[model samples]
Target chain A: MKRLKYILMTLCFSAAGLLQAQESMKSLMDERRENREANYAKWGPTSEHDGMGFIVRAGYVIGGTSPLPLPAEIRKINEFSPKGGFSLGIDGYKYFNMRWGLSAGLRFFMQGMHTGANVKNYGMSIVMGEDIVSGNFTGTDITETRMSGFTIPVMATYRVGARWTFNLGPYFSYWIYRDFDGHVFDGYLREGSPVGQKITISADNPAFYDFSDDMRSCSWGMEFCADFRVREHLNVFGLLDWGLSDVFKDDFQTVTFPMYPIYATLGVAYYY
Target chain B: MRKIFFGLSLAAILGLVSCIQDEPLNAECDIEQAVVVTDDAEAWLLNASEAVQDVPSADTTIVFYLREEFMDENYEGWDRLKDVAINFRLTPGATITPENGSAHDFTQGGVYYHVTSEDGAWQRNYHVMFIPVQPLTVTYDFENFRWESLERYCEWFEYSDQGNEINMWATANPGFAISKSSATPEEFPTIPWENESISGHSVKLETRDTGLFGVMMNMRIAAGNLFIGTFDVANALQDAMAATRFGLPFNKKPLRFEGYYKFKPGEKFQNRTGVIQEGWVDDPDLYAVLYENTDENGQSFTLQGDNVLTHPNIVALARVTDRVHDFDNWTHFDIPFEYYKEIDEERLKTYGYNLSVVFTSSIEGGAFCGAVGSTLLVDEVKVTCEDEDE
Candidate 1:
């Protein structure tokens, strides 16, 4: 037992030394990649072309959102967004030994958000003194809305090391579908009262009416994704997509104001 | 290769250590902060008297201006009016009552011309029947009665001590009386017999000696009489003067009455249609006879006090009777301005800017005789302008 223990201790020490040696190798590789990246940055695209190799990239697409304040009396009903969607893209390694590659692919990302708000139709009667007008009247309809849009990232990639890769470029997408269901002064005023007048409001026109219009259209922006390989041909990465163009053409006319769908995802990628 | 591998391993360890030091030192940026402070204190008064200015009095009369320029194109009948009296035991309440009078206009709404009350709690009310001399302006002399005194007469003495009662209630006084008469004294609700005559005439007070005389008269009307007139200035003035009673000029004239003579000098003494008798006679403890002038141009005009023999104007006082004017179809011919030349222009102007000279039946002596009632129609009766005099 004592001899076995000694053998085990020796094995452990050897393993520790091996790990230290491997760490040193990783640092050397990282330093080499950094030097190459600096050189590339100074001269733009580098000329280090190698044999053709395929890069399978997978990563988290992250997006930041700023909550917009609604109009004076407009109410937000509900928002539909994608909790998370998996993205997969393929890149063709061309030129010198997989050093530079051009990538092209389509990604179907869906974001469904659930949010809602309410608005108050303002009015007054002689019964209530003129001075004491209601700020938030009870007899007003609360507008409910649900928005959804799609994103597809397309770009080119340049690799500095076996694991480190940087991607830069633009993306295109279409808000294939959206639904908004509305009710006029729902549950607000009684049938016969003036306050009970049914009114349906929309984002398409300045006039409030008793109808609805479709809003799904094509909108696009830019994107940047970086991958850090955990091992050969495998990487965990981060991606950011910013909307270059507005989702709503007429943000002011749209009764619900402008809301651009943004997102962030965490995932893995495989490179060949 | 061995040396190279060893060098790489050492560099990797150092790099990891440097990477660990790159974390942010500050982490409190995400916490929320709040602050609160008090607002400034200030006072404000809205729509109060300080915010409004009184309408300045002008020598030029708006009533006369409107009368001439603005005529009611819808006038359908004769210019007729009745002064419906709204009496108050505490304060003499007067305003055009609803009587034959249209709801649209009343002296343009006629008001109770004069209010009389005796020492006793007994009060009497009377309404004047006449035509406007030109939608003559009707304004109450608010200063005439004490504010505290008039307040008691408002409705039933409620709201008597109001702070802004003077100006607030001035708009609804003798010229315009507001009623809160849900409760009223039983006996005082009706017009007194002395003031029952519809004509606008003289009030007779009798006296042996100046002492408390237990006499009273009062008038009350629910609604009905109204005044009608063209918007024409002349017509409005004529309609407004319909309910007015003119006091005789204080002149010493020795007169004799032999047989039945016309009370009026010429033409009809009282309007055949709109005639009213007003005034009364008091006789000490004996019989208090109340006479009204019903006959046009043919009634008596004299009032004798209980002390007629001892009175200064003994003869005139002895032969007093009720008189009414035959005012129908009469022009300004027989009764000229000279008829009442003894009346002081200044005194008449005080009641209003307009003054009308009318024939008066009287004895040579001045005496408090019986009352008289009569109706007279006056038109375009206003202050004589220098241009008109010329």
Candidate 2:
């Protein structure tokens, strides 16, 4: 848990450095670009609306999960280690003008989170198949999950001050695989309600569960991306795919949190 | 491109609110442990570990074995126990009757324990029975054996004290064996079959290590043992009343306790907390105690580890301290009853006196300290009633 905290902290501080570098790099290229401005009358297909092309990109994704309804104090989230996933996509775009455009694309990505927590005093009612995990907890708990799928996203794109670019879109996904599993250790479980007798969860008295097939197979969500061109045909990008649907099937409620996958990624792309 | 990506991200956020699923439930079904802490040494021992407690329930049954001679009608407890100060160690998400350890009036029926599964779909209803104290029988040959499907072994049950009829004996083997053992009589540790017995199979007790997990819970050692009353595991960690207890209601002043036994002591000498003694030797224990079954206020009391050997209420005692410690052959040994207080003849009819013939592989096993390889085998045990014809 402490390691995860430190990693996230590092990410927060490094973000600003990357942004500053990108801006400085953009400015350094601006003066040179002005000296070599393309002819407006005959810029060929490289200028604005005159262009129609495809771009392929691959990226590294970081996902975030929030276990809601369970107040922070109750679910004293102790450890969080988000496995970095990957995304690859191809998109075709047409510019209406130099600054505005529309794009549609197919993207494949894997997103999820691994976390350790403790349910101290807050009570939650969870259902895992024919079982119920309902009650407050003070024991160590861990949950690891993942969803791999493809998304069809329709994005609006904009070019800002030369080659700096941004895109945002809504997408629909059809997932091929998912896994949800966890363990509760050295704790007592009140089988039924708050007033239930306790079952010990320790080395001698242990418990583990799986909720893989019970997850949702299809969902809808949104994606956003920002890119800076390093060359005429190559661009480095950062993207965030925010899931709007719960990973679990409609009837499944084993996890008390309304968990949505917020995947963030950075990659390089080739425009052709 | 930036404008297009930003616009799509806003649109995805719109559906985020509607995608929330239902919540999960807590799945646990167990009665962790229970204890009694009333500060009445003459009546109730404060330590649950000294008594028979923490009895693991069958998936469907919650068993709370009581060890006293008579229950206080208002058994929420006396003095300390009534203040609702005692707590139950349950699963993280579990709740119990007498909500929050409040004073519960168990004078009528049972305490109910409901366990909800993790997925909110299923739950179990456990009927927790705190069997009140009653008189037990004498003269045990250790013959009755029945196979209960749950344990997949020959198991014996505690006889009811209410009806004054009993054909069974009790033991600390339940706590000693440690695991969810499903072995028959000829198995390891507790139920080892006795081949050299003069009669049917005798009881063979061997000391054991309950394992690392048991040690983590402070239950490191399990001494081979058999006794006359309850050994409730739920209250095993509290006071002697909750864990180690050894007397049942009896009327007459017994003359002697005679039994055939074989012995072998394990090499190591240690205490319940796992502290090893450098030069101490382990020895098996056997004794018969006749003590007052009622306190000064006429309240019921059962002899427990705290006061069994030294209590002022004791009327007679028969103990074996100089037995042949390493004998393998079945040997006959007898201890004559020594009287402390005069037997009150009228009190005998009122069931105010009790007798306990207890045996264990290690004398200090109750404190979680004992030798690991020690074994005690016994058969043909008989308690001489005070009848003149005998």
Candidate 3:
């Protein structure tokens, strides 16, 4: 009976200690929140990202360079043709109601795509960078392109049941890398095209067309995304980055067709 | 978690539904406009006393008809010459041969003009022939031809006629394949696929898929073709009406087009949208057009893909009816011309008409449709006259 009594007392002591430690941790956490609130009240926010959110994404960017207001044909996204890319950024949110909030973030999109096609006398114009000229081409030929950029998005978000979240907004992007490269061996280009002859354009011929500058410095588009909370501080998400602005400059008529960048991002987020 | 899952699913559906395929850019270079300058009081072309055809088309060709009175005594004792200094007005940044503004020696009958496109990537040659209007019936047997090479770029074959070499026979061969294969004309576009006693050598025209470039532009196939007139690169992307000239200036009222041909259409048909039309059988095109070569302004009219067969200027035309032909044997075709109006023999003998004989492995290839493997082998192409009967 004495031994039993000793065990019970020891268990009670341990429980007390655990409770005390929990109280201390809670206090510390509350103090930190208070400090954050105080700082927010005292100084203005400096970042466009939501005042308290972050996301890290690793997913394929599924899209192609196309004319604006994409056509039905482009709408049929080839699920297999998506390219590898990534997204990482922080955001700030302002909740107005139980289910209504606004958020903005500064993010970088490292996305790219490479697709192959067999067109018959594809009648179109090709334009390269500054050293430029537009030319028509027909016959069989092959081409590939890659692109990446930095983006800023402003979104309207809705939260449901404390575990579900949805966001829709417009995104602005500035490209850091751009390329439209390939070969024209099987067809003929009209005289006066930047690449004057029926020619092969590979890395070997640095003289090949580089359309990097032909891309617009700034682009804007609409997007929609959703997030599912996995833990108090962690969530998994998927997003769409739909561009509204043309990918080329206004005067750059070579790529006469209006094209925009529309892509998707699937990833995870750690938020405060 | 269930609500979150539902929301995510809804978003995914929206994303996919809102997505679309991008429209392709224009990647062609074609002559948008062409004109001839002169050294008369206003220094103009088409201003000669008897000049008829004047304004130029996007084909980079400028035709000027003279009254046979302007034949220069210095250059041609056999005929009078148009003593006007001729220049050119073409797409900005474009250049001309015989040096724009230089006096042309029309005494030799036909003066050749070469227009170098603004980008210096394409060139179109024109034959400015000044001859007394007469019956013209021509035949091509794929003989007496020579291939000219542009080093690693391209090569083309020329026809020898009228005591001179004619650059009239043009194929998209050099323009399409040379850049990638870096091949010469001897092996690239024409291989003289076969030789038959009736004609000697049959010209084989084959289509090819442009390797990497084809993928980028969505223009996958390059159909084999043989036709009269020049291929203007400038209009290829911007205007379908100006893309391919289906006819050339001719003064003859032809009654028939006789030729031996072998054909096999490609298995797939690819439209401008890049969709493969499965089970779509491609057909070879064998047709000709005879139209008023000059307009009221005395400007020469050249039929392009848009209006070739349907132009109001058409006076007569013909086309082969057989689409299915034996591959192992040459199929003889004799298509008679159908007249829309009575032949004005006198007017026809006065440079009043133009004709075109176009052959393609794919009938809709010019509009960006056809299978890649389509083939057309032709030999002993002849155009007979109806002088006595008509």
Candidate 4:
């Protein structure tokens, strides 16, 4: 009975100490929350309240408008280079809570690439005045593609910590300018089909082709973005835009495969 | 923090770069080369080089010229072509019908071969023939023409006394079709004109603009031309001067060349770059050349546009020096062959010489320098030969 009494007294003392520790922990958490709220109130645009805010972002874009798995007609890639384009956007966000938000943004971006590839029996068409010369070409092709457009993105956002936010959603783009042009050198073309008459194109006298009009005017795709807060109102962000639609229109058959526009951007975002 | 941001950016970029994978199976079907493997190639072929031929990407016909003696119907060697084996080099992963290296009777006509791509999505047909070397006709009326290349252009051919079609004439019509595929038969650089003629339809040659394609290639104009040899379309864009292989094998001596023609100069003459040349006028060209077909080393030789008149092996030349400006009336021209080198009588009987008769709308057309609307009409051409005594 004496030993049981001693054990009960020790357990009571331990429970009191644990209660005091819990009280201190709760107070500490409350103080941090108050400080965060004070900071949010001071910076109105960066607040986590249920209100609207805007952000402006600028970044460099680098990627290609290319066919998936590259068709067999392309025998080799001789050279490839990104044309060094940029993206600029303004986004409006509505925070539902500290962990959830929605954002809609309008962006203007440019994407371009230059490539040299060796192709065999590749289908193509070239404009000669009023005529469209369709043929299968077997030779070296040097191509350049450039596109500039305005995009509207609607995304759902999730905030993990005070400094991290993730965004994913669909984006619609309206292209104002598009260009897909190239030259075929040191090769031969079979007019009309693979079995058609052969016309040789020399390096000095390369055949030129432009398919700018065949590109689609509007495109929709998905974008994934992650933003890391670097300052009170500044963030470093990375975004990946994956195109679900083809770069060319449906009726365009000169390009044997469907080409998609895929790009990634890394830049800074300023909250206002 | 900066390191983390860079890490994420680098990873995203790397992912994008890795999207391109290995290429798939070949989608083209073609015969790159063709050859006849024989035990005695020298006895069967006219020349050793004739045993193998590198096929152009655009060509579907493979022709092998045989020795004249072997081509005789009564000769036993004529039957040997039935058992000869032929081999072909095809595009990778391509299969051919009747199998490669299979023997076929080429003495009857051209043997057809169909090639299918590895992916089985594309196919091409080829015609292979072994025939005797053909001879040029002595007279031309410019009355025979047919629509060729899916009816895209007009091609002229002759008929022998035996009523067999003789393909002894060539033109730049096929080359023009590359740039102007939608052009009508009458809009072509060379066409059969039914308006005026000595007896039948006359040949009309015109200088035409090659459109944007021509400007891009620095060959702005395509001048109409007719010749007694082959126009190698394979080299038409690369080396145009070498594309025109002039002359055909001839055993007789030509004394004179006679023809009727009407010519009109275009309003503005231009250089190769399509820039107008001040005070310059375009003129038509009519010429005949006879040259040794074999060099001193016994190798076969033929004249091209660059050296048809300047080669040291030339035996004779009959070129019109007078410029004809009349467009309304036909002018008759008869010129005697002027000799530059002595003829080898024994070699002449063995087909050692080659003769070519050429007509062009513009004299400098070979260099892509001409006027756009220059036209030349020609008809009733004849080549008179010397008697055996002379």
Candidate 5:
């Protein structure tokens, strides 16, 4: 009971500390916002300048040809076999005023690619004085490049002019799945198999491949869009969102593929 | 005016509440995001283990669950970002207990282990022990299992069809045995039961059409109790297997020589150095020899005697090479164990062992595969000795 009391006390103290820190941070932000408002007040007329209006737009985006070649090309170049999937995203936006608006919508995505091959060669040849077989040598030999993930876009747009709008945004993307496949054919191996088996290996048949949920995680990317309103309710636009950082839950290798799917959406939008 | 002020205050409070960001409506939010956080190191670990098909067959992976709490009443959107740092530690006595009663140390050799951290910024910690074999029943508390350091020998050979086919061979270091019985060819018609199972991973001469290679078992030969079967390369992957010997390599060339020996009576087997190669310079004069002897009944004994061979002897062993490319398919190569006359005499100073046959591979031929790698395989290996049941 005494121990429990101590634990509770410690937790209370921790919560108090967190609260204090948050208060200080909030205070600083409030002060900054006040200063910014004072500066803005100095720059312009305060009377209401614009009325609420509805606008509709439509546009087509020929997304940059994916930097990654087709699955076959990736597989051939890096021996990384790829599984094919499609990614399609459509977004709808509505603005109440020039600076205040909320866009609600969902995106559809499917992506995954992996390639694998077995290593099967062992033994040295006397005649050539070189490795006579295949897949018996072992070192850090990396093969096959694989990549996949899904994204959900949430954004806020500001109309800078009657025909032009600027969007400052954040996207929440969850990598649903990922796969890795490779091969190892080194002569040196643990003494046995998954089950203990001290038998002669017929061949260096080594296969490396994996598929898991571990690859999924939440990531932050930014979207910057400049839309040109062709009509009051219709506009053509281009959206580009680049991944500023990694999507890993831990510190590891940096993902170095297409950071953002830059696409031109050629769909129509309705405003009420 | 006061009423209007009250209304405005109420509106302000409502605005503050509305500005607060909401948490994911689904329980799967964090789980879905979890994949994004998997860093490269974690990916590598997963990939390596997957490559080798090493995974927990059960739900045994350690996990960290995070719950976010908003402290400030005005806590609003993602813009007011909070820096979150999470730390995970291995629980005390953390271990991987396989369903088969086998267990793994999650804090030692990292052979079957790895750790990765990345979820924007990464801070991860993990420890694991990788044993080459399984502990049948002994508890770790008893210190029954010990990690042994082995002086390993790794060599690669390659052969091209364009080169002149050559023959290569080499001898490996020898270790002591707990006990052994000798027998003649007539007495034991078949291979000894003790040597039935061969160590496929054994560092021995290999013939891959053109290239000759060698690998020596620098560690204790495990799983020899039921009988000293041939070394099994496949089983050594597990931690249960035992080690054999330790020593550095001296000869850079594939060992190839020929010699003869006859069994004697009432002699004890012990470690000894065989004859040295003829043309090769005897800088330290290193060679490998098998100890053998006979009993009063004329039965030959090839078991080790008291005096142990020095580590220097094992380290001094080397491969002899005439032409680097003189290594091809299995061509008969022999070594006269008596070649190391001085070393053999030293063995006479102790107890004399005889050489029945010799093995070798092209030790000098040093070429590499164009793209594909290579490996060596040995099957149906036998040792001839004098006849005797015990």
Candidate 6:
């Protein structure tokens, strides 16, 4: 009988300890909620509580629309320069809770690049009036690429504490203008194939090639972004857009390689 | 925050630099130089310099001329050539059939060497020959012509009395193909005129517009021309003056240049930039030149379009002075070769002189200044030579 009584007392003590632990855990949760509320309130009237808000963003872009794992035909990049480009956009953010949210935005962006590269056996087709001349070139290629477009991004956002947020999703772009032109110099071109008639191209009389018409009209990509709150209504942001579609049309065979438009942007945003 | 930015920048740069990995193998298969290995090269070759030939990028034939004594059927040099070895300097990593520096029987016409590129993606066939220097025929009938390998256009050639085809004529046809690839063989700047000839087929050279591509390249016109020498198409654009390498080694003294021609000029004479020059009348040109084949240093040399008529090495010249403009009927021209230097009899026997005959529809065609549609028809061209025994 005494052993049964002792077992009952031990069970009661265990139940009481469990209740106390549950009470402490509940208080801890309450404290964290309060802290989160206080942190959100510090962002002034721009910060929304389980609702929707708007943001205006402006950014600078400095990256190239290039091929992934560059092809072997491109032997070396002698020089590279990112021409000045910018992005301006407005985004709508809807919050479900303290941590999870959704964002959709439209942006106008422009990107330009100038590069000099050394290549060997690089196949290309140049526009000559109404016709095209196809050849394999081995020499220095100077290229200039420019693209301007309107982009729409839909993303899932996660808020980290009160000052930082991250988002990632798909983006759709429709190009308004595009240009891809270049010159090949200080080399010899085999007209048609590698074993065809050789034509020497000097620096002063380099061959010009333009593939602007071959560029695609629309491209889709993935965008990853981070925003850091600098003030109550202002935030600094960084974004990376990696194109999943090729820059050229499906039937274009001149470049022989698929190129992507991968760009990174750094900017500031104002929330309201 | 600053550290994060720095790290991201560094990562981007590293990613870019790391994309450049190992380079691809060379895709060019070419024989830059060829040399015949012999105990006494001077005894077997026409000139000691003839043993080694620097092959141009645009040429596929590597020819080494043999001494005149080797032409004798019983000469011992024939046996030596049958077992001769030729060494070739090829593009890096390229491989060749028949083995480099291996002996070959060049006496059986010639040997063909096939070179495969380092990447194994391309191959080029080269014809290497060791033959006695043969002179071209005294008369050109313009009746022998055939389509080139690509069948894009027709090219003119001559045949020896031994029934061997000789590539002694060159034109700007190859260069013209670049601009007007859709043109027919008959539409080319140089074509054989069948109905408009004195007797057999005659050569018709006409200046034609190069079209859109020519405009983009700032080369508005291509004047038809026929010359006795090799046309280096590789330099046709940037250095046109150097493209026309004139002359073939001659073993006899030239006496005169004789030919019959019909000429007609286009309506408007235009400059290279397509600017019409008022009151400018287009004129045809016909000339023959003889010059020393070797410089003072004993290196073989040939005249180019820039210096064919004005070079100090010229020994003789025969040019038509009284041109009959707009002659619809065939006009005869017989101009005597004016000798400026005494002929060295011993050098003449050894093929130490070079001869060239050039005819063009436009006099200033090399400068890209000419009238489109200017036409010149030539027939029965002849080069009279002195007797070898004299």
Model 3 has a DockQ score of 0.08
The candidate scoring highest on DockQ is 6
Local accuracy of candidate 1 as per-residue lDDT tens digits, A149-266: 4555666776765456677677777655544333333222111122122222222211112112434367666666666666555666665565555444552232334555445444
After superposition, candidate 6 runs with Cα above 4 Å error: A1-18, A41-50, B1-10, B13-17, B57-61, B388-390
Native-referenced DockQ of model 4:
0.46
Best by lDDT: 6
lDDT of 4 by residue, A1-272 (tens): 99999999999999999999999999999999888766554443333555578889998877778787677677777877777488999999987766578999999999888988888878888765576678888899998999999989899987766677889999998989999998899998877877676778889878777889899999999998888877877988888788889999997877878898877777899986
What TM-score do all the candidates reach, one by one? 0.27, 0.49, 0.51, 0.88, 0.28, 0.92
Per-residue accuracy of model 4 over B201-318 as CA lDDT, tens digit each? 9999999988887887788898999998888887787778888889988878998989999999988888988899988899999988999997888777889989988999999998
Candidate 3 per-residue lDDT, tens place, A160-179, comes to 54566789988888877776
Candidate 3 falls in which docking quality class? incorrect
lDDT score, candidate 4, position A191? 78
Q: Which parts of model 3 are misplaced by more than 4 Å? A: A1-272, B1-83, B87-137, B149-162, B177-191, B195-197, B296-298, B388-390
Give the fraction of reference interface contacts each candidate recovers.
0.00, 0.00, 0.12, 0.51, 0.08, 0.40
CA lDDT, every model vs. true structure: 0.30, 0.63, 0.60, 0.84, 0.29, 0.85
* lDDT of residue A58 for candidate 3: 42
| Ten contiguous residues with the weakest lDDT in model 3 chain A | A198-207
lDDT of 3 by residue, B100-190 (tens): 6676666565677776755465566766654432223378776645544434323233443334345566566644542234334444433
lDDT per residue as tens, model 6, B1-390: 534643574477458757886888888899989988876777879887888888877678888888878767788768877788899999899999999999989888899999999999889999998877777667888999999888977888888766778888999998888777777788788888998888889999999888876776677898999998988887877677788899888888899899899999988999989999999989889999999999999899999988999998999999998878756688999999999999999888888988889999998888889999899999999999998332
DockQ of each: 0.01, 0.04, 0.08, 0.46, 0.04, 0.47
Model 1 deviation from native, Cα RMSD in Å: 31.8
Q: In candidate 1, what are the lDDT values of residues B1-390, reduced to their tens digit? A: 223323443353233223322221211110011111112101111101111211111101111111211134344322322212221122222222232222322345333322222222222233322221232211211122232233422211111122112111111111111121122221111111223122331111111110111010011111111111111111111121222222111211212211111222221121212132233222111011112111234222222222212322222211224433333432321111212223334433222122112212222101212112212222221122222222
Ranking by lDDT: 6, 4, 2, 3, 1, 5
Candidate 5's residue-wise lDDT over B320-369, tens digit each?
22212211332222332222323344333222333212222211111111
lDDT per residue as tens, model 2, B1-390: 434544544344323323444433444544556554444433444112223345354334443335454355565443333232334555556555445455654434555656554445545566544444444555666765555343533454434435433523556654433332332444445563557676887878778766543444466677777777656543443332346666766766688888888888888887767878888888888888888876887666777766678888889988887867756577788878888888899778555676777888877777667888888888777778687354
Off by over 4 Å in 5: A1-96, A99-104, A112-152, A160-163, A180-207, A228-236, A251-272, B1-390
Tell me what TM-score chain A of model 5 achieves.
Answer: 0.39
Instruction: For candidate 2, report its TM-score.
Output: 0.49
Q: Candidate 4 regions off by >4 Å?
A: A1-51, A174-177, A213-218, A244-253, A256-258, B1-17, B39-44, B57-59, B97-99, B102-114, B122-127, B294-299, B388-390
